[model samples]
Target: MQPDWALLLLVANVSTLTVCMVLKLPQIITVIAAKNARGLSVRSLLLELTGFLVFLTYQTYYEYPLITYLEYPVLIVQDAILLMCVLFYNGNIGTALPYTVLFILCWRLITIHRLIIDLAMNLSTFISALSKFAQLQSLWKTCDSGQVSALTWGFAIYTICARIFTTLMTTQDTAVLFRYAVIGVLNTWVFATIIYYRKAGKRKD
Candidate 1:
């Protein structure tokens, strides 16, 4: 007998959460090891922040099924925590930046109306894509210089696999496909960087 679709989706949601959580380990390690974010890009982390908030808003507004509802919010919280660590490493704690206020306001407003939530999710997706693109460029530079973090590469590979799974499992033509396309690009860029770096040695700037 075929298994229940709902049950399958539940499992998928759990898998997504597990993947995202595991992927964050590299960032966590970076924060711990560097003792400072001297080489890290805050813009990338901020982009992640936007993506996560949008994901949370979209899921909440739609009242998406059990595991998904839980998964989205948890992922958002996880990103928030990881970003905080990045900020701490950057020594930007206690600063009254306008972005911080804007993020907070956006977060609160997302929970206010469905339309607003939809807008937030759309914006978040855009920001996340831009952030990942930036990360891809950064990784390429590091790989060329033989200075890339293995941890970052590892997490990126994991993220790519997860995106593949997500793209396959989700229905075709859904709005979520747009997000998957962004992830697909992210995966392709990382994979290319890894392959090129392994074979070409370090490229001179």
Candidate 2:
């Protein structure tokens, strides 16, 4: 990478990581405040968490630059906590144990073969996309934003854009780039849906 591109990449990664550090805090707060997960889709969170884990493993397996994927760990932690909060609010905390074990197993198995990670990385895009769709579906059905935080979704959009740029500068892996591009769009859609529902709810009230 050229020095200028390298510098931009570093900045993008740092900026992305900075946002991710608190990306899910808003949603967690919203959930706690409402004491409900009404408009939130647990499946969406699970798929998103899985995608993060698999993508991080794929990037590490290929020895991608640490800067390029550093946000994944932060995101994983945030999403995991958010997931637990959602489950707890929804009265399904017991289910977290199985999901946790499954994720651990899959994380360990994903790197066992190069092809597995490659295939997983691609499928993760679909899974992650489905996550957004699930959230959209929930929002549509509930017609309420409930505890869904517009701020968190907005932060997600920013991180996705940053990753898209850094991936282009660094690894430029098509799978990685495509993942960011698709999720960026999906995440935005989910964000917009949340905003729409929230506004509609406010107007109704």
Candidate 3:
């Protein structure tokens, strides 16, 4: 790749990922302003946080490029705030504070063997994908798509797809490729669910 073209690709990738991260802002705003988390899944948020944490650990251990892993901490913090909102809205602050402490403690205690960390990173990604399913199930049962920001999911799909493409161009690392593919599929499903439920609700009106 030419230097200019490579820089363009780098810029495009980072810009798209930034948009994905920014998309969460609306959700955070909605949750706070509405003071309700009707359709949001705390489990899903926590699972996402765990996945990011593990990925962060993996990247730091392996000394990956900053661009590749820079967003993990941002995402972890965003999810943590969202989790706090979920807890507060549900009147579970006592539980939330202790859980936060425990999370920090557990993160500190984890031993960082390369093989173990790699396995855990993959496992956490799988668990995050499952968590998306659980979140979709919640939306289905409630028929409430309000808690999920379609914009966020849409940008997520874009980000994951872009990452997959970038990975293919840069390195054919099967693990990275598979992880993003799974996440992309999951995000697409969630976005579809949001549209389906939104249309269903409107038709009922």
How do the residues 60-110 of candidate 1 rate in per-residue lDDT, one tens digit apiece?
566654444354565556566666776776677655267679888878878
Please provide TM-scores, in order, for all candidate models, with all chains considered together: 0.72, 0.96, 0.91
Model 2, backbone clash pairs (residues 3+ apart or across chains), number: 0
lDDT of each: 0.62, 0.90, 0.79
lDDT, candidate 3, equals 0.79
Ranking by TM-score: 2, 3, 1
Query: Could you give candidate 3's per-residue lDDT for residues 156-183 as a string of tens digits?
Result: 8887877777767675668778888888
Candidate 2 lDDT tens digits, 34-109 = 7888889999999999989989999889999897878889989989998999999888999999999999999999
Clashes of each: 0, 0, 0
lDDT of the structure predicted as candidate 2: 0.90
Q: Show model 2 residue runs off by greater than 4 Å.
A: 1-4
Worst 10 residues of 1 by lDDT: 143-152
Best by TM-score: 2
> Runs in model 1 with CA error above 4 Å?
4-11, 96-99, 140-173, 194-205
Q: What TM-score would candidate 1 get against the native?
A: 0.72
> At residue 53, what lDDT does model 3 achieve?
76
